[model samples]
Target: MDKASVDYTLYLVTDSTMIPANKTFLDQVSQAIDNGVTLVQLREKSLLTLDFINRAKETLQLCRKKGIPLIINDRVDVALAVDADGVHVGQDDMPATLVRKLIGPDKILGLSCGIPLEMEKAIEEGVVDYVGFGAMFPTKTKKDIKLDRFGQGPIGIRRLLRTLEKHNSSSERKIKCVAIGGINQSNAAKVLYQLNTPTQKVDGLAVVSCIMAAPDAAKATKDLIQIIHTPAPWTQALTITKEEPQSLENKIKTVTAKSPLVHHITNGVVKNFSANVTLAIGASPIMSEFGDEYEEFASTIDNICLVLNIGTPSPEMMNLFKHALQTYNKYGRMILLDPVACGATQARLNVVKELLNYGQVNVIKGNIGEISGILKLTSTYKQANGNEEEVLMKGVDSIAQLNEDDIISTGKQVSKDFKVVVVISGPINYVIHQDRYKSIPGGHPLMGTVTGTGCSLGSTIGSFIGAQADGRNKDKFDVYEAVIGAVELYNKAGREAAEEAKGSGTFMVKFIDKLFENTHNI
Candidate 1:
């Protein structure tokens, strides 16, 4: 990939639910562009071939108008139908070499290369434009997959950078590589730094959930663009932007300053952990899910931040969620819905969509599998044969087991449709909401080793945003600031907690312990 072609150096990818069916997908893509989205991808995982072709054609026209390239995910036919700038595919979805053949030489072609071996494969193929790596951590978007192959450890990202460096390096084929899965506002800096390796790193970052999951979609896209354009220092100030805050990472400083209270009506597995993580991230947490009191709580709480996480949903719990959604929408409170287990089954994906469509969600967070499900639901692309079968995802974890480009392309599509933030959590968290995007560089793989961690992070961010609503932060930097505060706090605590604990159990305990500790930076 040529450096000049990638203007921002980092890009935001959306999922279908990130937009609504009743809305215009192209319009959503345009909104992100207005916000600073540099590149766009059309992913119609669910729509029929003809429908996907139509939608892609429509979206591609918009992207071209903005001078932003449109990359289609999974289907070469759709890309051709729309005259897309490129197509992104995984190992199983379509071979990179074959995709290049289909698109001809003028268009871009990206492959999913999470492990060093895959990077080698991409090199061997020679037709790939850029390579994507990770499910940085476990995410709600593509729940069932695990990111073992990337093998960065707590510094798995550094390892990924090193591995990518080994393959198609300027010393070799000179291909570009970007990180994906869970790359978001909070962790953008950390991810980029590691990629830079105290040295100029690969081409750029391809993001999903982080950007897609923010309230200010436009700001999210811009932030990520800033991170991509600004390389980190080799020595200190690991911050993505100047500490002055007015710089690109302005949203981040605004977020951590307020210890906002986030209210979550989510699953049992990670509630306490989420609360602790929130506190650590310089926010407060109020976990209340009683159906009867929800409306009352919604009314009384000054900071109305709600997280609808269906980690283990029951009919009754879902009903409560519906009620909560009603309360949130009525009050104009910030709401984030993690479509837990969305893609594993058709019924689940449909329900997730129902919840999102029914609710006024500020952001939608999930993994590749879940995002794919949303695309299948909203877009016209039929889930290609062997696509799901090839996917060996297990739960709502951001850690990836597939290619990175597929994840980012889907994330971008979702972000465009929803007209909100869409985040696909992975190693290098992509936090893109419009032009505002930030890629948090590094945390611990232990993040996923502990269950409910992803859910907790989402809940924590909602709470931080809630503080502004609660009148806790008179300054009220913005919703994106609150999210950054939440993510930073969670990561710092997780990194600290990782010190005392080796396994998941200990990490969970220490994570909570650190979240509650005041000695650390909020």
Candidate 2:
């Protein structure tokens, strides 16, 4: 179950819309195969046995043709019906040990272990090939119940490693842990990367809704698998902005002067600081919530941008984000969402899910966890073992494991997934839009230990977009350029000030120094 040789990458499970029910059925299956999914799970929830058999036959054929492995979820009968590649059972969904006995070896066998007890039972049973654990986060279809600790988030890479350690003594089939729950393009690598021990790490991701829901399902599937299948050194820590050096510089200066006014429906922790950062960078800042003035406000303002955070979530605030988004659409305003602490809690992440339905966001900023929740990475929506104890969250910040590449990729993926600019801000700020990637590697390390840097970055972006809306600047100050520019200015300041500052107390002074320099004197 270690991270070294896990097979969890590129795992896909077909749980909904079975067997070419429509003309696109086979096309979808073909696309999944084309996307590089290494394994497929046929999860037939409500189909009649005969209908299920027929679909399984077709799926098995398609999978075999592609040379991809196939597993049937919760149905040992189906596994034998089509001589499917494998069978996945749950705590109550036919014991894997028994299914193994019935199906015999050579074929694969999978078990779903939602908790430690279930894991022990599955392990004791011993016939299982690999174990599946989750509804790791929260899902409507998964029937999230109140149990001791049935549902949780990514549980940090360290804890996931530990959990794998606990179960290492089990089967020699190389126990594989897969982090499921809303794993998306932005954060898939983060989850996989966190699984430190190759022997103990989960195999790959298991996504459902995301790949199925995209406008271009095939492209989405292909992209997700392409990135997943890509082995390490992993896309380098950061990539580049193809705008060319002159173009990039011009875009930055032009955007700052244009002065966009960004709207933030984000955390209270950095409200004031975020606004200040925006103003400091020569962009106007507007912090508004959902209210009678939402649409009205969006309409009145030409350069409108939106940001949503989960740090200090309130129902009132949540409602405000909804209204603001409504207003954003009415005005065709550009918006950005920060899925902060997204996978941390059901309530916190629900806001992100709801917001996804509303189109018109120009960017999304988040850490790895938030991004994973947004995408629902692979076939299963579950995390590996032992994470709750290790994954840390105080407010909305990422205080767990370190994954620079995954963080950077999360930003790049935001651009790809939503067709918007993505910013992953931390000790270093990564502004990724489209295929081009750029890293602003200047921020002080202390920035990570602080509170408002992230919120401030989002607000900074909003301000830049607002300025662009004034019609005074060239189109060069697009979202892509704005993000890079913001990171450069923000980090340059942090690093410069860190040279003279000793602690957080002096950090404020140096931050101001850097911010002031970047905004005016620079």
- Using TM-score, give the best candidate's number: 2
TM-score of 2: 0.51
Q: Measured by TM-score, how close is model 1 to the native structure?
A: 0.48
Q: After superposing candidate 1 on the true structure, give the runs of residues whose Cα lies further than 4 Å from its correct spot.
A: 1-259, 380-392, 397-403, 468-478, 516-522
lDDT of each: 0.62, 0.62
lDDT of 1 by residue, 1-522 (tens): 333366535566767666544445455566677777767766666899998887777777777777888888888887887677888887678777777778888888887755555666677767877777665545576554434422322134444555556553465546666767666654555465434543336466667655554555567777767755554321121112222333222333344544556778777777877776666655667878777777676676655578888878778887888888767654556778888877676556656755654455666777666666665533223323235433324655433355655656666656544544666666656555544555565458898776787787687567555654211234333444445445555566678888899798888878777766632442
RMSD of each: 15.6, 10.9
Per-residue lDDT of model 2, residues 35-75, tens digit only: 67777887778899998999899888888887777788877
